[model samples]
Each structure stands twice: as C-alpha cells, then as structure tokens.
Target: MKAVVFSRYGGPEVLEVRDVPEPKLGPESVLVDVRTVSVNPVDWQIAAGHLDSRFDVRFPVIPGWDVAGVVAEIGPTVTEFAVGDEVIGYVREDSIGRGTYAERVAAPLRTVARKPMNLGWEQAAAMPIAGLTAYQSLVRTLRVGPGDTVLIQAAAGGVGSFAVQIAVAMGARVIGSASDRNHDYLRQIGAEPVAYGPGLNECVRALTPQGVTAILDMYGGQTLTSSLDLLSDESKGRVVSLTNDGILEQGGTFVFARPSKADLDQLTRMAESGVLTPEISTVMDVTDAAEAFRLSQTGHVRGKIVLRVMGRLSAAIH
Candidate 1:
C-alpha cells in the first residue's frame, strides 16, 4: 500500500509517499479501503514534531486521524460492520505511527460510524474529528439548550463552523466571530456574525441584553477572556476552550473532545437530516499530503481540508 510517511519530523517537506506494508486486522478493528481523509491542525503539528513529548513516536510516521471509506475487511470479533459498509472514523490509535494518510487504515470498531446517506466520501471524511469536537464541546461539555444564546469563537474555521451549526440546531441563538469576509458565511449557517476583536463583547451584548448563556472557544487567550465578559452570568453560563488551557484558570472548561463511536453516530444522524453540513475548503489527491499540510499550516482555511485517496474526481461541496 502507498502511504505518506516522515522518517524525521521537520516540516511538510519531510512527508513523502512510499510503499508500506499493509496493516494486519486486529480482533476489534476493521480494515477500511480509504476513500478520503481530512487534514486537522494536529496533523501538521505532529508532522512538525511539536507533539513528540506527548505521544510515543516511531520513525516513518503517517500523520492523520479523520478517515471516510468502505470496509474491505472486518475483524473476526467485529459484528457492527461487514465487507462493504460505508463508514467514517476518527482513527486515533494509542500512540503514533500508522494513520489515515494512506490507502487504508485498521480502524477500531469503537471509532467507526455509518456514513450519513446525504454526505459524499469527502464530506464524510471531513466530519469525524472536526464535527465530533464541536458536538462534544457544545452538547457534552457546555450542555447548550433551547432559548439559550451561545457565542462561538473562530466560528468560520473547521470546528467552529460545525459548532455554530450544532448550537443552532439545538435551538440556541448563535453568535460567531470571524473577519468580515466570513461574516456572511456565518450568517448562512445560523450564527449572528460578530467581528472578532476588541469590540466582540459589546457586539454580542448589543444582540442580547442578558448576554450569552454559553461560550464555545476554539481560539483561546484574548479571544476567550474577552468572551467571558459576554456571559449572562459567571455562575450560570458555561465555557469550554479547544485551544488554551489557561481557560481553566479563568473558571472555564478545557475539553479535548475524545473520539467516541456514539458521538460520531449522533453527528451522522444530524447530517442525514440536513441539520449539520460540513464545509470543505480544499480538496487534493492523497499524494498531495504535503501541499495539503502546507495549506493547513496557514490557519486561514474556512473549513476542512480533505484528501481524496480514491475516486478523486468528485467535486467538493462549497
């Protein structure tokens, strides 16, 4: 099988496509003939050796976690899927080495979920990590509900975009922060756009006199500290941050959004009903993993960056 690997982490230039051995199917895993994989910030950060201390790394590491494909083979103990089930997964193993930046991946049954009928392979690939993070942060960490007003930081980015839609679908009025260019995009997804910066608090307060009932911070530091000012009440409103742990010092929750098959299923159901739609910013061939990583490092991506590992001609959803 052909896969991208890095013998030593330095930059995207260190990544190269090479022939590698096929992964053996474990009793609790499924072998997916990968159709697409999406790029997350962690992908580039790992490739750059930033997470070396956190995860045990073996040389020639393949970096990626989000995968969407068909099951080519199933493990002996696996009962939930079969020889040809369409699935999407967050394929994060215990350590680091084998990953989804390849033609196939041995995904644990616990990480796999049925691909929603309405989503394409690329969109399915885009949903796992980013969608799950947003869903868990809002639904699990904050418990956002109807009649509530929620503010999402970096709301036009990968997880933020999904967070905005999920909050709106849950009946919370959403206020999202982004540059003016993405403000209209935020509005289309149901979030009232607030230009991100010094005036964010006043902008959000202008919309709701009681201030926001919850806050989902994908960008930490100033972005988060300032958002806390918009909380309706410090004791009642909830806050969760994906980036900075300094939020914990400020009485906000810091969530890592652990991968869960159950949570992925709920996201799939929402996508099937047209409530959650993943936005794809760029699509490239699997061989172009380096270029895709370069795009991700810029941090200007509007949504998920996907790699088409199979059937690469399909158009990306705007």
Candidate 2:
C-alpha cells in the first residue's frame, strides 16, 4: 500500500508518499480501497504537533479523516457491508496515525456509512467530518427550530456550509458570517449573510436588535468570543461550538464530532432529498496531499478541499 506519512510532526513539507504496510484488518473493521479523501484543519494540526497533548504522536503518521471508497474486504464479524460496497467514513482512530490519506485504509464498522448516491466521489469524500460537525452542532447541541434565529460563524467553509443548510431545513432563520465575496454564496444556501470582522457584533445587532436565538461558532478565537457576545438570554443552552469547548462555561454546548452510523444515514437521506449538498472548493490527486494540505492550512477556502485517491483523474481546483 502507498500512504502519505510523516515520520515526525512538522509542516506539510514533511509529508511524503511511500510504500507502507497495509493496515491490519480487525474483526470489527473493513478494508477499503481508497477512492477519495478530504483534507481538514485537524489533519495539518496533528501533522504540525498541535494536538500532541491530546493524542500520542506516532512516527510516520498518516493524516486524514474523511474517505469515500469501495470495500475491498470485510472483517469476519462485520455483516453490515460486503466486498465491493461503496462506503464513506470518518476514519479517526484513538491515536493520530494510520489514516485515510493512502491507497487503502481499514475502517471500523462504527465509522462507515453507505455513500450518498446523489454525491460524486469527491463530494462524498467531503461529507463525514464537516457534515457530522454541522449535524451535531445544530441537531444535537443547539436544538435549532422554528422561530429561532441562529448565527453561524465561518458560514462559507466546509462545516458552516452544512450547518447553514441544516439550520434552514430545520426551520431556523440562519444568519451566516463570511467574507464579502461569499455573502452571495451564503444567501444561495438559504442564510442571510453578514460580513465577519472587527465590527461583527454590531453588524449582527443591526440585523436583529433582539440578538440571535442560537449561535454555532465553527471558527475559534475572535469568532468564539463574538458568538458569546451575540447570544441572547434565550440562547443560553442553544449555543454550540465545534472549535471551542470553553463555550460550555458560558451555558453553551461544545461539540466534538462523533462517528455515528445513524447520523451518516440521516445526512445521506437529506442529500438524496435535495435538502443538503456539499460545496467542494478544490480537488487534487492523493499524491498531491502536501500541496492540498498547504491550501487547507490557509483557512481561507470557501468550502472543502478533496483529494481524488483512485482512478485516472489527478487534478487540482482552486
């Protein structure tokens, strides 16, 4: 198997494609021949050693989470899928190494879901992490619904794109924060766009003096503080965050994406029904992971950055 691995924590420059041992199959896992994978902030963060305190760093770490692939082999105890079944997964393990950034990966049954038929390989590969983040943030944590006005930070990015659509589908009025260029794009996704910057709180206030009934902060730092400041008294428990757990102290819910087959099924149903769609900003070959990581680390992409892992297609889109 060929995998992109970094022998030590460093920059994207440290990543290299090399032949490596195939992941050992488990009784509860399936071996997938990777078709596509998506680059996420956590992939580069773990590569750069930012998550050292939280997870043990293993040498030759394979950094990736989202995957869309065909099942090459299924474990003896895994009855949910069979050989050649199309699947998608959030292939996160307890440690940081051995991931989907390769030609193949052994994914646990718990993290895999049937690929949404409405999506292509690139689109399907882009869903798991960001889709789950948005699903958990709005449905599980924020409980957004009718008559509620929800404000979502980083509204044009991967998770925020999904969050905006899901909130709108749930009957919540969505106010999204993005750059001026993405404001129109946000409106197309059913969110009322607002420019995010030094005057974000004031701009939001101008939109609705009563303040937001719920807030989901996908971007941390300034956005987290701004989200806290924008929350109405009625939104005490309606606030959710994907990047900051500190929101819990302010009566908000801090969400870490969980691998749930049920959630994937729901997201699949929504996509099939035309209520949700993934916005992909870039696609590159698996061999181009270093460059893809560079683009993802910039934190300015409008949506997801995907790597086409299999097939004759080797491309990059900005």
Candidate 3:
C-alpha cells in the first residue's frame, strides 16, 4: 500500500510518499480502503516531535487520524460493519506508527462510524477529530444549552467551525472570535462574530451585556487568558480549552478529544439532518501531503484540509 511517512521529526518537508506494507488488522477492527484523509494540527505536531513525550512513536511513522472510506475487510470479531460499508473514523491507536494516511487503515470499532450519506468523502473525513472535539467540549463538558450565550475562540478554524454549529444546534447563542475576514463566515454558521486580539472581551461583552454563559477556547496562552473574564459569574467554571491544561488551575476544563462511536454517530446524524456541515479549506492529493501539512501549519486555514487517496474510479464505484 502507498502512504505518506516521515522517518524523523521535523517539518512538512520531512514527509514523503512511499510504498509501505499493509496494516495488520486487529480482532476488533476493520480494514478501510481509504478514500480521503484530513489533516489535523496534531498530525503535523507529532511529525515535528512536539508530542514525543506524550505518544509512543516508531520510525517511519504514518501521520494521520481522520479517515473516510469503504470497509474492504472486517476483523473476525467485528460485526458492526462489513466489507463495503461506508465509514469515517478517527483512527488514533495507542501508538503512533501506523495511521490513516494510507490507502487503507485498520480502524478499531470504537473509533469508526458509518459515514453521513449527505456528506462527501472530503467532508466526512474532515468531521471525526474536529467534530468530535467540539461535540465533546460543548455537549459533554460545558453542557451548553438554550438561553446560554457561548463564546468560541478561533471560531472560523476547523474545531471552532464545528463548535459554533454544534452550540447553535443545542440552542446556545454563539459568539465566535475570528478576524474581520471570517466574521461573515461565522455569522452564516449561526454565530455572532467578534474580531479577535485586543479588546476581545469587550467585543464579546458588547454583544451580551452580562457576559457569555460558556466559552470554548481552541487557542491557549493569551487567547484563553483574555477570555476568562468574559464569562458570567455563574458560568465562570464553564470555560473549556483544547490547547491549554493550565485551564484546570483557573477552575476551567481542558479537553482532549476522545474517540467514541456514539459521539461520531451523533455528529453523523447532525450532518444527515443538515444541522452540521464541514468547511473544507483545501483538498490535495495524498502525494502532496507535504504541501498539505505546510498549509495546516500556517494556522490561517478557515477549515479542514483533506487529502484524496483513492482515484476517480474508486470514488464513482462507491
């Protein structure tokens, strides 16, 4: 099978497309013939050795976690899906060598879900990590709901975009912070847009005089610190950060997205019902993974970046 691999820690330039052996399927996993894979910041961060102390890494690592494809084979103990089932998965294993950046991936049942029929390959691939992160942070952690005004930092980015939509669907009024360029995009997705940077708190307060009921911060450091005072007294503990663990010290929660088939199914249902949509910023061939990683590293993309693995013939057949 052909896949993108990086032998050493560095940047996107270290990535290369190469022929690798097929992934070994586990008893509770299924082999997916990958149609599309999406780039997440964690993928490149791992490749750059940023997560070395956190995850076990082997040489010649394949860096990807999001996959949308068809099941080509099922494990002996897997009964949830069969060969030909269309699926999307967040294929993060206990280790970091084999991944979803290839022509196929052996995905455990816990992380795989039936793809939303309404979504294309790219959109389906884009949903897993980003969508799950937002869903868990808002619905599970903050418990956002009607009458609550929620502020989402970096609302135009991948996780932020999904966060905005999910919070809106849950009946929370969403205030998303982004640049002026993404303000219109934020409003189109049901969020009241606020510009980021200095005075971000005031901008959010201007929309809701009493301060927001909840806050989801995708960026940490100054971004998270500045938004702390913008939460209502009753909602001060409702803040959640995806990138900062120091949030715990501030009486807030720090979330690391976990793979849950139930959560993915809920997201799939939302997409099928037209309540959730993935914003794809770019689509590149799998061979150009280096460039795709570079694009993701820029930290300016509006949404997910996807890589096409299967060609047109396979796509048409499915």
TM-score of each prediction: 0.95, 0.95, 0.97
- Each model's lDDT: 0.88, 0.88, 0.92
Question: Which TM-score value belongs to model 1?
Answer: 0.95
Q: Tens digit of lDDT per residue, candidate 1, span 1-318?
A: 778889998888998877788998999999999999999999989988888888999878988999999999999999999899999999998799998988889999889999999999889999999999999999998888898889898899999999999999998989998989999999999999989887888888888878888888877767777778778765343888888878887788888767799999999999999999999999989778889988988878899999988743222111
The local distance difference test score of model 3 is: 0.92
- Candidate 3 on 50-169: residue-level lDDT in tens? 999988999899989999999999999988998999999998888899988888899999999999999999999999999999999999998989999999999999999999999999
Candidate 3: clashing pairs of residues: none
* Per-residue lDDT of candidate 2, residues 1-318 (tens digit): 677789987888998877778799999999999999998888998988988988877788888989999999999999999999999999888888898888889999989999999899999998999999999889987778999899989999989999999999999999999999999999999999999888888889999888899888877777687667677875666778777778778777788799998999899999989999999999888778889889988889988999987742222210
User: Per lDDT, what order, best first?
Assistant: 3, 1, 2
- The residue pairs in collision within model 1 are none
Regarding lDDT, does 2 or 3 come out ahead? 3
Model 1: CA > 4 A from native: 234-237, 311-318
Give candidate 3's root-mean-square deviation (CA, Å): 2.8
| lDDT of model number 1 | 0.88
